[model samples]
Target chain A: MTVRDPKQWRLLETGLRRAAENFAIDRALLESHQAGTSPHTLRFLRFHPSALLGFHQNVEQELNLDYIRAHDIDIQRRLTGGGAIYFAPEHLGWELFLDKAVLGTADMTVIARRICEAAAAGLSSLGVDARFRPRNDIEVDGRKISGTGGAFDGDSILYQGTVLVAFDVERMLRVLRIPAEKLSDKAIASAGERVVSLQGLLGSPPALDTVRQALATAFGQAFGALFETESQLNPAELPLYEDALAEIDCNDWIYQRNRPETEAPMREAIHRCRGGTLRCGVVLDEPRQRLNQVWITGDFFAAPRRLVVDLESALRNTALVDLERNVGRFFDGYPVQMMMLGPDDFAAAIRSAVASVPEPVDG
Target chain B: MQACNGCEFIGTLYYDPEFQIWVRREQNGSLTVGMTDISQTVAGKILHVRVRRPGTRRPAGKPVATVESGKWAGPVPNYFDCVIIEGNPAVLADPPLLNADPYGAWISRVEPTLGADLALADFLTGETAFAGYCERVRNEGIQCERRTG
Candidate 1:
């Protein structure tokens, strides 16, 4: 197999655009580039204050749509699978429009990682010591500097990411209905742990141009390809972009295609004892009949106090039936000193909490 | 390797996809599928892979393999209803084998009871695979440099 030279790829900076327009361009360019008509290209784009959810995400569960509407922030759905996100002017978006052939495979997921880690390398080039976090995040010391995802068809794929040159965690707290995210300082602190942006870490956000250059340079190095700056959209892409934007820009395009939010209940169950009151809120993936997320919070006294955090991580996206087994399995391995807190007690708290809810079955 | 038409593998593999693990079926009466290079590209140096065991009936479209990347759970599914014929427990215990040699490692052995599906066709190669890819790109909204292969 032969690889394309660096000079073969192109780069474009498509300034601020609406979410639909951006997504449509993703569709158009990925299709064209993979068809052999467009060059393997990297595009730098920006969004005007939006709260977007991954394709598989539920709106009500992932976002506070009311808050977005009131704030005049755009609400859009990304054509990728991952968590929902809040993007604003403070963030920069970067995407790759390339063929699977260039990456050398037809696997969509693999393409995302290749691009993300390369971007992570670019961040590293920027002296951020950034690293790729599995599934879909680039983090700096465990706090994400960028979050990415993609949509693909055949060989053409669109892998896009949000570079947090700057971020607004407070607005994110309001835009996404992350349960108890704003309830307290600790809760907000927890939210901060899960996300990070440039301004928050560096005191000042770098220029957008600098970040884009780092990314392009990093990707070029990763692929051993040269990137020539260009500002051109191929003819093959216009019609597809138009059609996609038309459908994507409208509410009908975004909503009414998905199952109801009630299918994924944000059910909560709590248990209290001397150790601490454990509050377990679960978002069920009804189709798979599993716990999409398990949030365990409590006023408990446990050493390596990140035990709850680890436990939450251990049980993430687990099937409900596997919940108890996972919890027991977790305790058996993790050596933690919990005063007045037993393994079974913690498991029982979560199990009973799940049972208490007559969760709405998938209709 | 090119037995079933233009079926092919691209350059150096990378682990860089979202949940970058998957199962593909080949007609050798056994599946010849594994993770793509790009999947490993972004996995940030995969620590391990946990493929499903042979004789384990993984229903169509469900995870038949579980790979761990950066301590996050990544699921790889058999695109069709499958029965594992051969899988490596050795690699399962060490996971990086999938990243080190994705195509050579061949994650699992499953015979798609329904044969290979068309949806799986795009990922796999047949005669004219490259041309088909080119067609896909032509439809996308991106400008390109000319190609002559």
Candidate 2:
């Protein structure tokens, strides 16, 4: 199939909306595009303080519901795959709806990397040194600024990401069930070390329109296409949006996967080595006996602080049995200079956390 | 078993190349469904697998199971209308088994509904299945990678 119009695409800006409405539009646009009723689109969206879960994620396992309820933050599940994220009005959401054939590649990793690189280019246009990290993140100076994911149905695909324009990191820490300590100054500082916002980096947030234009220009140059801005949904997309809203704006859809929180527990362990005390916080999936996520923070003096983040990335979604081996391989490959720390220290720290809890008996 | 374009397909099972799923008829007349090697390779590593509970009736082309990877997630569609009888506990416990040996890892078992045809014209078997899969892989420009433990 040849390109319908190689140099032309639609640019859509759906202003701030409730979480369910945004997700409804997500389904409506992707489904319509898949059915060949909608044009190739680039959409910019924002949410009014929502906590979104990945499609496959269980709500109880990923969020602090009590906090979310008290704060009146809307909770909705995303159509994409990844971890949970907190969305705010100031966060600029950008998405591209295109057919896989347009990219001339069927590999998801390659496609994600291409789109993330383009987004990184857009951020760079704001005078920030942003670069694409592996998997799905755009970071500047080793601090993540944008996180991305995608959902595909048939030939159509929707790849979307959030740009932290003027984010509230403290609220994010409260809403998501992360591995860090809860609601402490130290934890908030630790979280700040990893995530950065446009306001934090630039001293003031860029206007939403400016951010959208930069992204549009970057995507246009990347795909060699011209954007025709549309302020409303295409006529073909309205009926689909209504159908999606009817199905998605309800408790049945929002709480579809409500597993018990005990199934995924945060276990912490502190290992005292000759170098220093290394503390590890691990979110373990007891049913599958796998590490859902791992975070290490300690007083150890390891040069190149980014190494810790890289190690954490390597350990994400790793099997418990393979923890040591994977950690060993990461240390072996990375060039690090530590005063008294050895690779074994990191491995032992994680193992200590795993062994802290007794294995649950099979039912 | 036969190998085509680096993907292995069981000789006895029926395959739907368009949906990228394999179906096996059990001795008890039920059918087992799983993803093909081409599907798993294109999807990358399998991180999670969720199968529909038993006693649910679904139409053809609907999801019997959903598989997620690090970057991609989608449903494993059944080619014929059926009622799900059981989900594979082994695959649910360890999803990477689907990537390690997609042929050996069945995702769900279902009993065909009344008036549903057991043998569809698109279902392929033996050498015909192998050739069709190879052609599809070529057309999609996919290179199957050997699974590691």
Candidate 3:
């Protein structure tokens, strides 16, 4: 397919590239467009096995470098927000390069939802139940089918995400900090509950072409435009890509500019409750003097699985004293179900952990 | 709020004569810095503001913080050495605040170990900052909060 007009959004498929190259191309296109040298684009890319951290994330805490190196997985940091994600050749990646004028809003969170909802409509057309989950994720039922993030400049924008046509939870555990690291049979099951894949949904991975076509169609409708396939980067973007790739592909580009990972110890608190054993992994955000990430797991049954995921995300990165307020606020509006599990139980577990260091006092 | 000499930079900016630099915030005798209004118009609608952690280290004349919007990402280039002060767990929570109050709701602040008062003096303000702001406003398509000179 050939693009005849610069205004017409172009669609291109860049076969699997290392994380750096793919991300560098992202930088190049966004930069070129910001400089008023490039056009709106839709790109389909695939990643060689890699674990990616968010732009502001600490590498040490987010990834399992040993597993990444031994498995020959590429590691890179994203230019967006949210948590870390594990990407590989098996998952299909999609990105939209457009001007913010198309969306009529400057808010990233709102932009994320509009794009996800449109993609959900496209996914729904493919006979799969897909919907946009708040704060920037697309899911089938309550399980995540797509995770996304975005970057913007001047008027040009790049919002991207991956759909798990095929994925491995066990491999992800090796690359990420799982809620439970016991590595026992129980650990694997626990990890499975937290993540789901398309293969598990369809009994086999969807073909690559089918996934791309669906995404392209989704994006086309989302933007109310037509997509004509192309084979290369825009000429204006080539020079920029080269420059960006040079910086990002090397160690200094990757690690030289980074801060020492925020090494908040993974402290655990076992609270004996009549209902069940509640185990919490509590971490502190030293900079904010707050409770960063918290995981509550152990023979716990919660209804509306999204509630658990939402609760975890709510408390995932919160301040210590702010814990009770956050939990209470989340329950105040969020529809969650745990017959015996109360907000106080949640607050108690977090309080027990915050009591240890007492923050600024000790350190 | 404690008395501090800081000026607001709207879509287009003006620098105060009394203060050479637009102090983002004053903390423990340190200055937090960021771009003025004239900067954001050129930058575009901020999609995401990614700042280093509070304890994150930095050298002067470095890209300490990064802001992303409309698919483009650029460093919030700084003119002084700094370290992020404790507050705001993640930039994602209130990224727009960077634009709403770029100087007040700063991206990050330097703890001012090496250069404090000296660097602040050299920072832009008055007719000089206003001139710089106008150039940015025109070069990068943007409207001003008030009619500029």
Candidate 4:
């Protein structure tokens, strides 16, 4: 069915909700849009302190349950794919529900880049020099401002992202098990180098309305469509949302993918490099022979400190066999200054962490 | 293996190009299913995979497995109504193996539901599989890249 108003789309503003409610809307809207009962939509959402896991992630593998329970933070799994993240009232969530035909490409990578570029444009309109980082992050001067991911069914797709308005890096560190040091001033500073908020980038946080308008307008221009603001879910979407809520609001659904913490072991290695002691903590997926995540920290001094985070991001989900080449490629293109540290030093740090594990027998 | 428009298709397996899934009928009347090279190429590097546990029953076209890549997550629909007999442990442990060896990595095994025949007209094998893949590649502008370490 062709769109009656090719130049028109709906803009949904669902104000602050609990994690389960937000995810319920995610399911209902994506399914309804795929069924052709709903129009293309750009939704703005807010959450009340929630710890969201990627759909396939295990809670124990990603979050600090004890702290989360103590703080009374809600937990829910996102329909989109990516790593886990901490959300609060200060963050703004933006989602787009459309079809593959609308994007004119079946390639998920290209689709992500296009959406992220548009989101980056919207952030830029807010006076931040935001750019789309490869894979799925929107950054300004190497510090990430927004992270995005997508979930698709048939021809329809739901792509969503978080825009940090007045972020609390310390609270995030407490919520997610990122293998970083405890929430100290130094650790917070380190976390701040990788993530930036609107309030942090600008002197003060922009109004929520202004943030929404900037993003909606930028998306409108990107898709060549006009947005008609809607405050409520359409009639066809309400029941669907309820059904989804019933399924997603319970622990059974949230913990459906529970895996043992032992499976994802944190292997730490200390490498005494010429520059400094480069310490690496790797979350190794032993059975897969893959690096689930990498964290580099030490008494090292590398100029443009964001490089460490960038290198860590580069090695995330990389195969053990590709470690050297991946690090080599990252350094080959990334311009950085270090007194005596080289790309091999980083590789060695990761290798040392991998060496902690015994070789896997053939299947 | 037969190469068609940059995609490699195993001659021994029956493929449904429209769904980008391949099925192999085992001697015990069970079918092993997995995504094809074209699907893996379009999906990019996979980070997580979850197949329906054994004893779960699903209709034809229903998802038997869900795969998540860097930016995308979606279902891997089966070609026939079946009850899952087993989920591949290796693929569950390491999803990137799907991209590394699409044909060799089976995601799940399932027995056909009652009254469902294994020989469906939609299933393509041998030369017909290559031809179907070729047509899809042309229409979809798909460029398959072999996964290399």
Chain A TM-score compared with the true chain A, each model in order: 0.85, 0.95, 0.91, 0.94
Q: Give the TM-score of candidate 4.
A: 0.93
Interface RMSD of 3: 8.3
TM-score of every candidate: 0.66, 0.94, 0.75, 0.93
Number of the predicted model whose DockQ against the real structure is largest:
4
Which digits, one per residue and each the tens of the lDDT, describe model 4 over residues A1-363? 535354678999999999999999999998888778889999999999999999888888788888899999999999999889999998999999988888888899999999999999999999999999988999999899999999998778999999999988888988987554536687678778889999999989999989999999899989898888898999989999999999999999999987766777777778997789987778877667788889887888787867898898888888898999999989999889988889999999999977875323211
Order of quality (DockQ): 4, 2, 3, 1
lDDT of 1 by residue, B52-121 (tens): 5578877754556655443233455445576777667555534556656655666666766666553344
Per-residue accuracy of model 3 over B91-129 as CA lDDT, tens digit each: 455565555655556555567656566655555554566
Question: What is the Å distance of residue A333 in model 4 from its true position?
Answer: 3.5
Per lDDT, what order, best first?
A: 4, 2, 3, 1
Summed backbone clashes in each candidate are 47, 0, 16, 0
User: What does candidate 2's lDDT look like per residue over A1-363, in tens digits?
Assistant: 334565688999999999999999999998788778778899999999999998888988889888899999999988888889999999999999988878778788889999999999999999899999988999999899999998887667899999999878899988987654535787688778889999999999999988998999999989988989898888878998999999989989988888777887888888999999988888888888889888888888987878888999888888988888888889888989998889889989999988787323212
Q: All models, DockQ values?
A: 0.04, 0.59, 0.13, 0.72
lDDT of each: 0.65, 0.85, 0.66, 0.86
Where model 1 places Cα greater than 4 Å from the true spot, the runs are A1-7, A105-110, A180-182, A272-277, A285-288, A300-316, A327-346, A356-363, B1-149
lDDT of 3 by residue, A9-116 (tens): 778889998999899988887777666676677888999988887765666666666677889988887765556789978988888877666776554556778888
State residue B133's C-alpha deviation in candidate 2, in Å.
1.8
**Which of 1 and 3 is ahead in lDDT?**
3
